[model samples]
Target: MADAWLVVIDHQRIFADPASEWCAPRFAETAPVVARLATHFDDRVLLTRWLPGTNRNGSWRAYFDKWPFADRPDEDPFFDLVPTARDLTDRPTVDVTTFGKWGPELAAVTGQYPHLVLAGVATDCCVISTALAAADAGCTVTVISDACAGSSDENHAAALQVMGLYAPQITVLDSATVLA
Candidate 1:
């Protein structure tokens, strides 16, 4: 098996539930792929949940204020990971308030690896943010294209293209290729 860490981002009910305002259309298709990737990575997987905190800085406070519905309580089902992709491994999950997972708290978890395979919801948002940060942290990042869903198909493809521009340090590939 490849000695790469798998980072699954924001595959929670708020983003995956079609009924929710934050739903990503491709989540249904991406969930199973993410699950399979998580299973393959096993102990090397790190699942990230975007949980907005009550306290925010500047623009983040305004951003959350504009979308008050997103201020979900900690126990709300909206914050939980989708059933199809939940708890597949014994590894601890990292929760961040921002779009990127490479925040101070996650540095220790991510710094241990030199290569990372990224997956999950909103390819244009959290997924891309995390991927770039991973590359900056000196990790070779490979994004599983089919395993990530964005707000729209166009945005998803655009983000992939942007990441591709990063070249050797960050590449876009499918789960089949990575798993193989």
Candidate 2:
């Protein structure tokens, strides 16, 4: 696990806070596990925030229209890393507007081909997106199942199953197994 880079994707207040309309039900429960991953991965961890994209062009225009609440300025506390996990890693937080954060920002952090151990919120959405893209880009990805929260339990399970189809490229495991 020494070379594994942990990417904590979109573990932000919007997904972790219970009062948010888009909150993931298990966000709080999963956060501690992610924090533990950060500690284990140390400086190799990259914590990400889903900031509303300024380029509201193309399909993204409709995306923002569907979730107007997220269109707030980047400074909004709603987009901040959840307080409990804020200091989990000292690496600069990667701010991405796209659901799949496997672009230049991430590649710059871990290089072109990295062993990415993924964790964080909306397992059905952001986590799944990042996993698939990174895997497609020739990086081996391991998703820490227990360390991710989704919009619902069913969705989380479904996403894990989908990712498992990628086999060797993307392997989903619990935190205990991953940390071991």
Tens digit per residue, CA lDDT, model 2, 2-41: 9989999988889977789899999889878988888898
What TM-score, over all chains together, does every model reach? 0.93, 0.96
Q: After superposition, how far is residue 69 of candidate 2 from its true place, in Å?
A: 1.3
lDDT of each: 0.85, 0.89
Among the numbered candidates, top TM-score falls to: 2
The global Cα lDDT (0 to 1) of model 1 is 0.85
- Clashes (candidate 1): 0
Model 2, position 127: C-alpha lDDT score? 92
